[model samples]
Target: MKRREFIGLVGGAAVWPLAAQGQQAATRVIGVLALESLPRTRASLAPAQRRLAEMGYVEGQNLAFEYRAADNQEDRLAALVGDLVQRRVSVIVAPAGPPIVAAKAATTSIPIIFFTGFDPVSSGFVASLNRPGGNATGISVLHTEVLAKRLELLRELVPRAKSVAYLRSSTNLVSDHDRIGKLQPAATALGVELLFVEASRPDDFEGAFAKIVSAKADAMLVSADAFMFSNQTALVDLAARHKIPAVYPSREFAARGGLASYGTNYPEAYRQLGDYLGRVLNGEKPENLPVQQVTTLQLVINMKTAKALGVAASPFLLARADEVIE
Candidate 1:
């Protein structure tokens, strides 16, 4: 968060006082490697912090959270990870996506904990789920595995829609192409055409939306990834301006006013992350800890947004939703 001066302020806030009182070992520090500004991560971070507190790891008494946020810049991640490593934190929390990659690369011995939508094994974050053979393990939602279901939900929200726009980040071309291949079968089965558009950087968003408009897509599916999630406000605004119904990968999007979202339970994932963090802090090796897979998925609908767009969510779908925003 406050990296410059605070980066130097580690061992922990309680470090100096405890050392002066001959009790320097009284605190444990959890270094967080965030991919966005600290404020942006508050929603995800709170649950983990609260869960930790419930487990008796109270801040300013027995715990400290030292963190480094890249402010949404992937390039800055390596340096931030390096700083966290240098701080000699008891545990490192990489907040999904690129930051995890950088954290793993930067440290092999330090215990690393993360919550990722990406497949942990294929992404090389772990050797296996049942037995993580390395110093990193946390919640794995495997969002790609649910792509088909997400598409089906979009069709449910936009019945009679023949064309749907799918917006994805273009930073990883090979992976994106692979993901698209997986989604095609679902599109074919639904008899809906998926118009693909991409934006890897902020500057490219306008052009991507222009392409979506030109394609005349009846609805949009914002792919699950940190890039899209971080820029959700802009994406939601663009969808509103275009008046195209859209379903997002994370509920935060629908909460920010996208039509709806059907994806992994994010806050729940972080709570699970907190549980693992506490486990590791209590002298457990990451290699011995099996990665936790979050199987719960949730649908969130914003009722006012649906009304504003002059679209009605299927009553059947509404009844099944975990939360419907008014």
Candidate 2:
């Protein structure tokens, strides 16, 4: 994609028109609280806006968005959500796990929409999936359950891999620990030793890669989280520098030259979120709208990255992938 085209696709176009138009008398403003920076979070928002536009809510026309990015700082989320709540936004849209948690805590009266990988009910974000029973509901990607399958795919791609390094954000300790717990047995069953690496910031990436190399990990499976996703380019470069085949959770990784990715279609989920937001704005209650589960999944492989790592792409995997980067 051309630079301008990519920017528009990712919702990075200038917001001059949006700001100039201000909030219409009947237009409702939706607060978007993202856990990462604008550039990193744009990918998740583009599809949602497109979906909303299709549902008759045009930016600067019928709908206005109040966006705030925490830039991966957990400490700042509560304050950000509080500002949005004070602004009296018609609804709140949280892109990552923590932002959703913060939004839920910030207000109970305003409807909140979320795109999360964690179990809403288990995480205490909702009463149940079928009926959220509150002013919150959106979509679930079911990321935890896919741990086994991700490991299986990594092993399938690198059969002789004796060790696998798992990278996660150290800041989100609870989720990080839970993810490792879920993947440990699966790694053992596949006869692969699992090495854990925690890096909470961009500056920690080089050291983390050094640790991965020292641990003698033959491949890596990156844990899915907002922090990790924020440093996608850096992570992809480090994996390539170490010549270690790695798998990620989203196609954006593969698009940026990661070896492979297997997970829910994130853009589709965002589009669904937009549709649901439209419904909420049009006299529908969040509790009444059942939390939707992402049914479509995508597998993406980058042949160039595969070759750079000296690993040949398996024909079976290539055939099954939804997209391949040559």
Candidate 3:
């Protein structure tokens, strides 16, 4: 048997039946604070739940979740986080920078575990990566730090394009100044003019596309923000209708019909969140758990989307991709 299974079996033989009954009666609560809709957040959190289960945190027995989602309305995050704080949940897990900021503002005593797309230190999520020195700690997707790499990949996909548009959430603090500033140098070095297109709400997506078209951008790159990811379908559809070759932040976008994507595996980041939360539940302090940076980057290309957009995927680029969806 696997180590976890073996341990579960051995632990069950001793004090499980009786102790588990009492534990079931008093479930350890985990609050989920998210900016995405409940359905989307829950779907994204599956890997977390699986990881928790592997650590012997079985739902309805030893663990319970109190879920709250903003459904893309970022203003609702503060209220949702307040609700979790008032409930005094044992732990609060926040995904992405916005929710993490909200949770950090909500309570200092209530342990907060985050899975963010930007640098945790630069975003003020933690004091430092090696030592959080506070109650919030988890994984960082390093999206902002990878802007140049994403831009490089986009340039590779659209080599002859002289200009590129970066589609980002107007309200994304991480992408607005920091990531955009980082992309400028990369764009300059690549000999491509970079344009910024902002869409805060779902209603602004079309307007952003119009702005891109107005700027005469030859290609586009979607910023790695939760709000943008939640609206990937609409963004991908817009890119298709506008006939702009686009590169996204994750494989899910490519799988949803975008031209290509390059970034860290977020589901695994959530699993890391779950594992860290499990440790916190087992008496580890959040301050002691160093923030983790996701290092496993992936490139995904959709040959079908490339063909539909009349962009030829070089055989070499396809060979380097981690996955290619036909």
TM-scores, all candidates, are 0.89, 0.90, 0.91
Greater lDDT among 2 and 3 belongs to 3
User: Against the true structure, candidate 3 has what lDDT?
Assistant: 0.89
Candidate 2 C-alpha lDDT tens digits along 1-326: 79988888667446755654564566889999998997767767889899889989998888898889988888899999999999999999987788988999899999999988877777777898888998999998857888778899998889989999988776443554566788988987899898888888788999999999988898999988888889899999888878889999989899999999999888888899999999999989999988899978888989888887778878888899899899
For 271-315, candidate 1 gives per-residue lDDT tens digits of 989989998998999999998988899889999999998887888
TM-score attained by model 3: 0.91
Best by lDDT: 3
- Extract clashing residue pairs from model 1: none
Model 2: per-residue Cα lDDT at residue 201 = 77
Clashing pairs in 2: none
Best first by lDDT, ranked: 3, 2, 1
Q: Each prediction's Cα lDDT score? A: 0.85, 0.86, 0.89
Candidate 3: residue 324 Cα off by (Å): 1.2
Which runs of model 1 end up more than 4 angstroms from their true locations? Answer: 1-23, 171-178
Q: Superposing every Cα of model 1 onto the true structure, what RMSD results?
A: 7.1
Error of 3 at 137 (Å): 0.5
Question: RMSD to native for every prediction?
Answer: 7.1, 9.7, 7.8
